[model samples]
Target chain A: MKGYLGIDVGSVSTNLVFLDEEGRVREAIYLRTRGQPINALQEGLRQLAGRLPENTGILGVGATGSGRFLAGIIAGADVVKNEITSHAVAASTLVPGVQTILEIGGQDSKIIILRNGVVTDFAMNTVCAAGTGSFLDQQAARLNIPIEEFGQLALQSTAPVRIAGRCAVFAESDMIHKQQMGYSLPDILAGLCEALVRNYLNNVGKGKEILPPVVFQGGVAANAGMRRAFEQALGWKVYVPPHYDVMGAVGAALLAREKMAGGGSTRFRGFGVADTNFKAGGFTCENCPNLCEVVEITCEGEAVARWGDRCGRWSGSLGYQDEEIRNAV
Target chain B: MKVTFPHMGHMWICLSAMLEYLGVNVVVPPPTSKRTLTLGARHAPEFACLPLKLNLGNFMEAAEQGADTILMAGGCGPCRFGYYAQVEHAILEDLGYNYRLVVLEPPRKHIGELLSKIKYITGHNSWREVIKGIYFGYQKARMVDDLEKQAHFLRPREVQRGSTDRAFKRALQEVIAARDPQDLPKVREKVRRIMGAVAVKPRPVLRVGIVGEIFTLLEPFVNYDLERKLGYLGVETDRSIYLSEWINDHLFLGLVRGQRSRKEACRAAAPYLNHFVGGHGQETVGSAVIYARQGYDGVIQLLPFTCMPEIVAHSVLPGISNELGIPVLSITVDEQSGEAGLVTRLEAFVDLLARRKGVVVQ
Candidate 1:
């Protein structure tokens, strides 16, 4: 079997997916980033390698999400794209006429408005990570409930309480207050989901003409409570694709397929990279007043990538110029 | 008296050159950096906009370098910036920096005050020499702005990455080192030739108009070098305001030919914003409309956090964007803005533009 590999190393979770030659997801691996993207990616790749059948031929690789540049260099991605493009592509591909895509990941939430299979407008949360998957996870942990069961609890609510959701810290305090007021756990959870949906609509989805065929993806889509809240608020049937959590990976794999459609070889570093010893370190460049903190990634004690310098001195030293990254995107 | 001023993109070059021509000792603040922002944010009011914080940082750094006199521009308007000079001075005095602030207020309403401030800074220079120095500085400002504008034009088309920035930096040095006013025209011609010779690939480039508060539009540090970033993303940018344009609009230099009149912008913005809400609010709306009508791909608005006028402008931007069928991305920057977040939005915005225009094959 021949397939394309897609890796999405986001803030909260790193997801890996393998798309067969026909673009069907053959294998998917999801792992917690745990504040270490490299380790999470390696673990994911290891799991994916074990899951794939013997003699599986990897044709291409793609990377997305915030840690895309890091993932690209490590995975040797043939296509590197931003999360918005990746999500939109995946949503549209799966749900042919997906007009609206609501993606709430760990640290970011975005709304992509598409028309006639092309993206028209989009918006991402600005400097605020409130009402995202991570916030939900924190609330679920505080309530002593597993994140997977948080949504099911919300569905049992008979009377949903209103919780403030403008800011995450305030929202937590509001939830605690509601709990103190003796509101049922289900009601409070449902209300929290509704509040998050309201905030998402007012902020990220502000001024966006969200018509029918709304698709909600990202890790947050796994929450039935959020899905219900979105339906109640938007009054539209929201579709969650089968692989909502790994949609970014799916989109990346699709893009990789398109990039390699012209019949060119991919830059896949091979699955052996999972076992390769890699080290990441950073140093503050004091050569100038700016004092840029440059990060370097090494494989087998040899530096492979360097970045984060403003003047491109240290970053350019490794010959992994941004021009190549930009071209890939 | 060692004179010092805040950095606004390349305005430092123009100001330092003008002061040097007037036979005044000048202390240029070091280029804005993370330390500058940290120092500024620590001393400045928590709610003050990014520009004010940066100005405070510039003063503190300049004071440490033995600068005893600070040159700051003053204005009278609805914008909070009119009181920035006073607030910055108070903050510096509280920080124990015994620096004298010579604020040149708008010449229209404070002609006597402006002249005295200039006279104090210029010392024994005759009125003729002062006027000549001012004109010389104005020339340099125009040349510098022209070079920057040319660089923006060349950045998206340059065959070699970073070549346009390289030429721009070298050209700025030549403009700064220029001593004689007569040599400015020669430098201007040379700059044109240098920018023209940057080896362009002749590829069609997306044009983006930048509109927002003047400080954010002029200062690269506050907005994170937005123009350079967009240029590198294969988009050409035309900003609403430049230092030279601001100088022309506010100073007696309005008589300078070729300087765009604020009246035109006000006229263009009349439909969306009839009156000046201050701090380039009307101009922001007008520039967006102008860019859209000019067949530009999109408009980006840069606003400093807590800026009153720009917040109003931002609210009105969506209407214009929808009516005009152009995409507008309003980015707010404060002390906490991360570069990664900005880049992601920019890349997504560029991707949207590319898809809309059918430029991206995939």
Candidate 2:
């Protein structure tokens, strides 16, 4: 059996998905990043190795995430894409009519406004943690509730309290105040859920024409409480796809499938990538005052890729080695 | 040789003082007056930011006055400041300026490369002297900054009773005449004494944070002297585009790795705001939060029209205001931005904040 593998290593989570030749997800693994993506990818690959058919040939491999550049080096990615493009493609593929996507991941949150399956406007909140899964995890911990049970607690709330959802500090104080007033844990949890949803809508969704067929993905979508909150706030049905957590990887695999079907040869390094020795080294380029700190990845002393350059100087310098290095594998 | 340094708000004053200490003749383009804007607007690319245009104008004016060298700083980041030096160098060269442009890239993973650039620019072969020059330069910059911040609070009230510009000019002249750091205290004392004598006003004023596109925020011509205009309307401004903040964020933050100062910035801004609203929205949130807490009437966030980071901040600010119960007005200005429209918005935002705070406009 021939198949494709996709890997997404974000700051918060690492996801790996396998798709058959027809672009159907055969299996997917989602693992917490826990500060190290290398180990997570290895473990994810080990699980996939167990699930795949014996003697299955991995036809193509693609990677995307904040760590896409790093993952591309590790997985020998045939294609690499930014999270925005990857998420939009995945959501569009799942809903076919997805006009808006609200993807709140473990560390970052992004709102993508789409018109006719094309992304028109998008904003990413990478610098703050207020509307992210990490924030929810922290709140769940503060409430002494198991993170897994948070959504269930929210679901049980008959009347959720209204807490200030703007800043995390105010939200925490408000949550504590409600708790002091003898509000039920479920009500507080639901309020926290609503606060997060309201914060996301007010911040990222501001002035945006967020139409229907809205798809919510990322790790946050796993929470039923958040989904309910979003539905209640927007007055529209929000769809949570079955494979919400690993949509980025799934989208990468889908993109690879489309590219491969276009008659162009796949640049995938194949399953043997797991066996390759890759090393990354960085050096400062003092060619001009814009001293670009360039990072280079080498496979057995041959430079495979170079990035982290501000100017295209270093990358442009290595343009000659592209075909030679790609053909070497 | 006479040299010119791009004005990074009050940092240019420090740079000038440092340059003077080095025995280098420093020519600062006059402090962002109308003529500076007229010259910048006439010469700058329409899409370029007001700060860049203003600085370019300053540099041009200085160059025309026989300044033979230009010193620019460099960085590597998502912020366009990293590329400003290279682009400005090309633009200046295109204008047929005969001056040599010296760009000093911040020392990143490599210290040796940074030292080389420093040696090249200062024309001082000794590393110790280069270090000392920077040390003294920083001291002078901080002193200048300290005085300028005081001026922001004092200027509007002094001007409210008339002769505000006169008071500021006299204070700056005293600061400029100081011989060294020790003399700064006396200079500051004199300025304070002068400001103390100026009549003070008792009405509440709107406080706005001018942020986004470093050039636009600092260059008066680009924003059409928005700060002065705001002050004229009894508005107090808190701008977050200080060179110190930029240096702390871009350079020092990285040196102390794993600390996540961006998160810290958000947390610090939390009392005033919640979550990152995008771009420098955190700073906008910080300013707004601080303004509201400090009893400032309103917060105005300014960005060059079409600037990506400010746009992101603008989208997030309305929600911030909604939550904080503080009013925030977002102003995006480009070449075509009308002075009349900006004045109208500023007047409305101030009135709104005053009404919300129950401050009677006397």
TM-score of chain A of each: 0.98, 0.88
lDDT of 1 at A136: 95
Q: Summarize candidate 1's per-residue lDDT along B78-172 as a digit string, tens digits.
A: 89888898899999888788989888888899899889988999999999999999888888998888898898988988888788988998888
- Candidate 2 global TM-score: 0.52
Count clashing residue pairs in model 2.
4
Clash pairs, model 2 backbone: A167-B274, B51-B215, B51-B216, B272-B289
- Most DockQ-accurate candidate: 1
Error of 2 at B307 (Å): 9.4
Report residue A71 deviation for candidate 1 (angstroms).
Answer: 0.4
lDDT by residue (tens digit), candidate 2, B216-332: 666555566677666655666766565545554654544434322445446657754465443465775555555566665566677875566566666666666666655666667
Supply the DockQ value of model 2: 0.01
- What does the lDDT come to for candidate 1? 0.90
* Candidate 2 lDDT for residue A73: 66
Candidate 2 lDDT by residue in tens digits, A68-158: 7677767766666567767877899878989999999887788876666665556665224686888889988887888889998899999
